[model samples]
Target: MASVVLTACQEEEGAEEGETPEVSVVVSLAIFDDFARQLGGDRVDVPTLVPGGADPHTYEPGPSRVAELTKADLVIMNGLGLEAGLEDVIEENTPSSTPIVELAEGLPVIDGNPHLWLDVQNAIAYVEHIHDALVEIDPAGAEAYRANTDRYLAELQALDEEVAAAIDSIPSERRKLVTFHDAFPYLALRYGLEVVSVVVASPGKEPSAKDVANLVDAIVEEDVPAVFKEPQLNARILELAADDAGVEVCTLYSGTLDKKVDTYVKLMRFNAKELARCLG
Candidate 1:
């Protein structure tokens, strides 16, 4: 009878060992979640803290999201002050045993601009980071992660070359960028362009009359041709300021993904195409 009981217990343990627990990933934004999905393949499930079209700088995760973070196997974040509002929640909810990966690790980060994925090279670095983190979390999926990262890295290299060609079409003198926020420094740096001035210093902060006036003077001084507004933010103020400064207003994606440019590759291409159209 004792032998029979031991045999039944061993059978139950064998069944449990064969079961695969679902791997959970909590990403700070949609783009990172998308990247995670690409690398994780079908082996992992990712939940985004910031919804599509939501600004990462000001996004606040709700109770449901907090619970998701607590149970996640891995937590991915942009990690350059982009998710300022949800940092507390991410820290508090995530278990110490769970691995937290900052996708922007090893990328050249600017002091104030957290939009690292705007530059294709930075995005490539992010993919590498994601790949390594996923492999560490699920060693069984290491080969898949490496293969996916290599494929994605090739695409990013192609994108880098495409963006370079697009920016090369613009005259060096016409390569000035004026935006609603100081978000595109990495993009400008990567493409050999210049950021003349930004309307606001921080996210969600509106430009004052005096601030607008100062930007107008700088724009006139720099002879900037276009002012770029982020698609996720209200552009009325930027439009009015651009009119005052005698510059055209164009749209750029900052922290959020838009419907048209849903993927990271598409987002960079869209920005390049728009910049070429406006500045070329």
Candidate 2:
């Protein structure tokens, strides 16, 4: 939720055709960092503020990270509240002339949820935004950025289709989600799955006894075969709830990445397969 407070940086046209511009970029999360890399290729240096396997909802940026931000040619974050921990620090330290772009700024938001990229279509939109931001800062590399963006967009379309097929494999009655946090609404909406229960509304919030009770009840009532716990967020509460409900717990990638899945595309494929295995 940071405003681009500084004056716009001067436009430059230096890189020749077929060569990539070397732009320093600081991204707030790993997923967005991957998106920038997919679009920028070898030209952009995307240093993620939040580390992999860490929950961005509760993550705080440190001094070393601030130093990176200060020198970054472009600063990018997922707006809507994903960078809640880094917003103030970035705004305070970034140069007035550099552009700080929020990848999710212009996309459709659902109930103010910051996990818009969970939907493949929304992720495509984010890549488009990244392309525009890259071009604006490096007009010389516009062709390169556009080519990279188009290629990644096509791959994203294939990913969307693949996810749809995987989800469709599950029986309609079992297409439901019980997750650690309210982070799967967009994904659920995309695949026609319902978010039956969640341990907490957002990261860092403690769940009440009633919340646990309701979650277990919903699991039983909905008859979902398995509940999901994100790799990055603590899921003890969710595990206990699932145990109480007598259903097995499975893994899902939400706000962050881990060893098994390091990139956004891998994360989506992992989710689709896990969902099918756990629910089909």
Candidate 3:
């Protein structure tokens, strides 16, 4: 509800009194919300369901949020189990005519991680699908959506190369990554980094003592340089694993974004740099 109110400011200051309102969109997470805004520009009302710095894995939408979803012209979701907490609400509330598009539909699914956008390649796919959906929903804005998609894809392509090169700079022996959860499989597969082990399988899930023990064994055996913690998840378990393994602990951003790194481009750049710092 707070997120809906925050993004509902579109009606406050603009235009003639009789202009047609933009198509309203409700996105399940912050990243998709940014994607809608960037591609739709002023032609779409994109209200992010999960607020910034929140975990989509555990975010529960309230009644007001369900109402917004019911009235939205489109509901965009990652659809790879990223928003497990909202499944019932989305199924029960979204109108039948409202088109619900899943950005991760055709992408390669990692075993347990649904963070496909972490890979710029997968993000390009997301942009293409979003462009198609936007064009289908708002034919009048087709030209604008195409232009924005082209420009954004170019930027993503450049970011892809930059991430590849930056990750390549790290020696092969140091390319192993250990993080709080299994959120980096796509990233590690896209880059050359190997996921040594993850402390937890998913966000908001606690690891068992046996799981932690096994992770510590892997970390110590692999001599992992660091165990990364995500901003949206509690880092205490990662801290325990790192301490047991005698390695450094660092931070990584996964499902959440802030003012400092709000967009997908900035978020990827920040993550690449942080990984390089930790592993290179």
Ten-residue stretch with the least lDDT total in model 3: 12-21
Candidate 3: which stretches are off by over 4 Å? 1-21
**lDDT string, candidate 3, 180-205, tens digits:** 87888889999988998888777777
Per-residue lDDT of 102 in model 1: 80
RMSD per candidate (Å) reads 5.0, 7.8, 7.5
Candidate with better TM-score, 1 vs 2: 2
lDDT by residue (1-280, candidate 2, tens digit) is 1233332222222333235437988999899889999888878888889999888988997788888988888998889887788889889988998899987787778899989999999999888888888998888779888999999999999999999999999999999899998999999999889988888988888999999999999999989899999888778988998888899999989989877799999999999999999999
TM-score of 2: 0.92
* Top candidate when judged by lDDT against the true structure: 2
lDDT of each: 0.86, 0.88, 0.86
Better of 1 and 3 by TM-score: 3
Model 1 has a clash total of 0
Candidate 1, residue 213: lDDT: 86
Runs off by more than 4 Å, candidate 2: 1-21
